[model samples]
Target: MASQGDRARDALLDAAEELFARNGIDAVSNRRIVEHAGAANHSAVAYHFGGRDGLLRALVERHHEEMSRRRRELMEQLGESPNIHELVTARLRPLIELLDSLPKPSWRAQFMSQISAVPSAVAVAKEVIGDANLPDDLRFINGAVDGIPESVLRGRAYLLGSMVVGVCADQEAKMNEDANKGNWEQVGRFLIDAAAGMIGAPVTDPDGAVRYPNVPLI
Candidate 1:
């Protein structure tokens, strides 16, 4: 049986997620979270999660455990070798699946989208869920865009993160308006195709000059 403390903690997390997703993280107060959770104690957030940062870490870690499991399963099925598309699919599908598993009007995507914009919150997220640094395919991607300027390569990496987070957040917001409005599987496939295309696209210099040095991309 779950203790009252555990139940209170979970309530606080749920309230915080919804509040933060709907009204940016910084805008939501700890007191508001406690009240929203229906906890008698005003310090419920502190007592349950230690503080705001701890609360954020707990939220990220909760989803991260499932995500890690799904990612491991996907990677195992890929065997020893996988192409860029397969690798991108493996990396992305777990998140899409996670979002799919969530109930309608979910705030997970928006929660993460907001977190990504805050450096401190993003650090906690990265600490819990790891970053976008895909080491295994570094060499492969480097070779794929060997001739492209490092600036362009770096820009694409940033854009890909924003694209995934932004699109998911937007879709979730839309779904809240009409439960049957969106198809996440289709969105996931489109994202996979778009990401793979961006990664594999030929580098065409608009000007006849290269701006960035030929640095090996990470």
Candidate 2:
């Protein structure tokens, strides 16, 4: 059983997520969240979440929880051992699905872009989603890099992560540029294929590097 206050708080969080995802954290005001939540108390944001920063943390936590749930389910479906490509696909599928599930894609796109642009938000994101948070289905992907030296793995992982972020950011930018002209479903599919290809490509030594399969620039 939940109290009325609890219900109000939950409503506030829901409204905040909707606004924050669409408009970016800084763009949305506490008053707007309270109004959107249908709360009469003007201090609802502070009462429920301490303040704006607290609200932002709550939003980030909500995303983290949703991601963790999807990751767990995907891992459970994969069984004991899966290959690198499977691991990469499993890791990416939840993210694609999460974005697709949002009611307003434009809002989500703007929200994600804003988060990426903020250095502090980036640090928070990295802390919340470090290597330990990698799903079990994708463990083999990490294992695949075991043959590569630690330094090389670190470098490659950084590069690959940046590539994936860039792909997502570009998709968001394209969506913003021509809302009616682009389809996320199609772009998401292409991204998954492209990411899988990159994950499957062989790693090279740090020294200048050998010729490897070129990751197609999109």
Candidate 3:
């Protein structure tokens, strides 16, 4: 069984995630989180998490553990070699699976999206969760294309992150409406297809010169 302190800490995390999702993370004060958590101590957040930054890191690390586990399993299933599409799916599927498992009115996706907007928070998240850029993953990506600049590939990787976060946030937000329910399966497929193309797409220079014009997209 969890101790009372553990329960209080979890309550604060839960409340903070919801409030941050509903009202941008910057707008939701630590006091609001404490009150929403129903903790008797006004300094419960500070006592439990140290501060808002610590609380955010805790929330991200909690989910990242599960996501990382799922990614490892997916990567293991890929065996010795995998194509771009398979690699992209492996990288992206965990978030979709996590969201699918959540009940209605989930705040996780929105919370992540809000966090991505804050550079400091994003750095903290990167410190905790890292990214999809595993060694093998990067090796595969680097050799997947020829003549494309490494700089362009780096930019595409950042684009993929922003795209996934923004799309997931939008889908979660629309869950409140009667019509237009979020279709995560379709979303997953779309992301996988789009990301594969993005990862291996031809790089064009400003002067209309295309690098790796023969690059095949997945």
Candidate 4:
């Protein structure tokens, strides 16, 4: 059985996620979150999470545990050799699956999108990332590509992550009891295809030159 304190902490996180998702993170106050959680003590969040940043970190960590498990399973299936598509799918499938499982009016995707856009939220994520064991979804994809600088690859990955978060937020916004499940499936497939191209695309030379096989030189 969960301790009363643990349950109170979880309630705060759930409340915070919904509030942060519906309203921008900046717009939601700590008092609002505490109230929404139904905790008799406004200090429950402070007692459990220390503060807003701590609360945010806890929420992100909760989702990371869910997503990381799925990521590792996909990585195992991909084995020693996997295509870019497979790798991209592994990176994204967890979030998509999570969205599918959440109840209607769920706010997780939008909350994540907010996190991606906020420096504080991103900093919280960075802290967690530093401590956590992230699935190296880019390893095989990195091996396949040639001539692209490591910095460039990192930039592309950042862009790809932003796109995925933003798109899913949009998907969740549009979702309701009347919404078609096919739309969500199509969005997931589209994101996978686009991400594969993005992560695998050849980099151009610094001196205004193109080296990718198909593109004509400028």
Candidate 5:
């Protein structure tokens, strides 16, 4: 038995996710969200979420929760102690899949692009990452980082994360330009290969020492 306020809040959230995903978060107005939610009170968003920033935070938190749930499900499907590649793929795929399945991919792209450009979005992203309690996933990633030095591992992780974010942002731009045409599978494959190659095995001996792969150093 949900209260009227609770129901209104949920409706607002539902409307906000779609609206924010389609339009940039800054572009979508509180009035529009309330209108979209079919709430009789025009101030429903304010009443429910306090204000626009509060609404955005709620949306981000909900997305984090959903991502966590999807990651857990993927890990369960993979069974115990999956390889680094499997772990990374499992964590990354769901987000791409979500964007692909959105009713208006262009809107998602717009939203993501705005998020990429904003400093506050970075803060929100860091909060989500730090607050995420995925021990199994963390263990798998840390194990992958084992052979590499902490500095290199941190740099590599940042690079890999940035690459994924860049690719997603690029995809969104492409989707906006040509809504009817795009090869998500091809993009996914390219990212998988690119990320793997960047973070792939260190060229080394039995002892924990760095070694270059036997090829023309890039």
Candidate 6:
């Protein structure tokens, strides 16, 4: 049997997720969260999650546990050497795996879209992942992109992350609106390909010359 506190905490988390997804995190208030949860005390968010930021961190941490586990398993399967495509897939597959398992009309994709968009929220997310050891595929991917110009590499990483989150959020919205509209595996493969291209693209010089002509862009 769940304790009253556990139930309250769960309720708070649920309400927070729904509200955050519907209205960006900054727009939602602690009072709104408590009210939505049907929690008696106004301080329930504080007691259960410490505060708004804590609530967001807890939400991401909860999801990341399973997501990270699957990612680690993927890394293990690929050993220490994975191609750019496999490495990109390793980074991306966990999110789809999680998306499939979540409740219908899940707000997690929107939540992630918002979280990764805001610097403060991104900091909280990084804090959640800080405890987990880095996966091998991540290390490989890092090394693989080592030759890229530092500026270009950083820019592409930002673009890649934003693109994936935005696309997945849109896809989730589509699925919620019409379940049969989106194909999960195909979408996942497409995202993997997109991310791989972004990371492995050839850097072009101002004179229209490709920095690494030998490297395939796609």
Please, what is the whole-model Cα lDDT of each candidate in the order they appear? Answer: 0.76, 0.62, 0.76, 0.74, 0.63, 0.73
Query: Higher TM-score: candidate 1 or 5?
Result: 1
lDDT (10s digit) by residue, model 5, range 2-112: 998788887898788667766667677889999999988888877878887777667666556676788788878985666667767776776776667665543443444
lDDT per residue for candidate 2 within 50-102, as digits (tens), equals 88767666666666677778876877788676766666666666767766675
Let me know the TM-score candidate 4 reaches against the reference structure: 0.84
TM-score, every prediction: 0.84, 0.67, 0.85, 0.84, 0.67, 0.83
1-218: candidate 1 lDDT, tens digit per residue:
99988888888988999999999988989999999988889988888888889999898887777776877688778756676788678778988998888877799888878886567777787676555543343334555454666556555655666788889999999988987876899989999999888866777762433233222111
Model 6: residues with Cα > 4 Å off, grouped in runs = 116-119, 130-137, 145-147, 206-218
Off by over 4 Å in 3: 131-139, 206-218
Best by TM-score: 3
- CA deviation > 4 Å runs, candidate 4: 130-135, 176-178, 181-183, 205-218
Output the lDDT of residue 65, model 4: 78
The model with the greater TM-score, 1 or 6, is 1
lDDT, candidate 3, at 180: 66
Candidate 3 lDDT over residue span 96-124, tens digit each? 98988787778888888887656667767
**Candidate that beats the other on lDDT, 3 or 5, i.e. the better one:** 3
lDDT of 5 at 173: 67
RMSD of each: 4.5, 6.1, 5.3, 6.4, 7.5, 5.9
Total backbone clashes of candidate 4, pairs 3 or more residues apart or in separate chains: 0
What TM-score should be assigned to candidate 1? 0.84
Name the runs in model 1 displaced over 4 angstroms.
131-154, 205-218
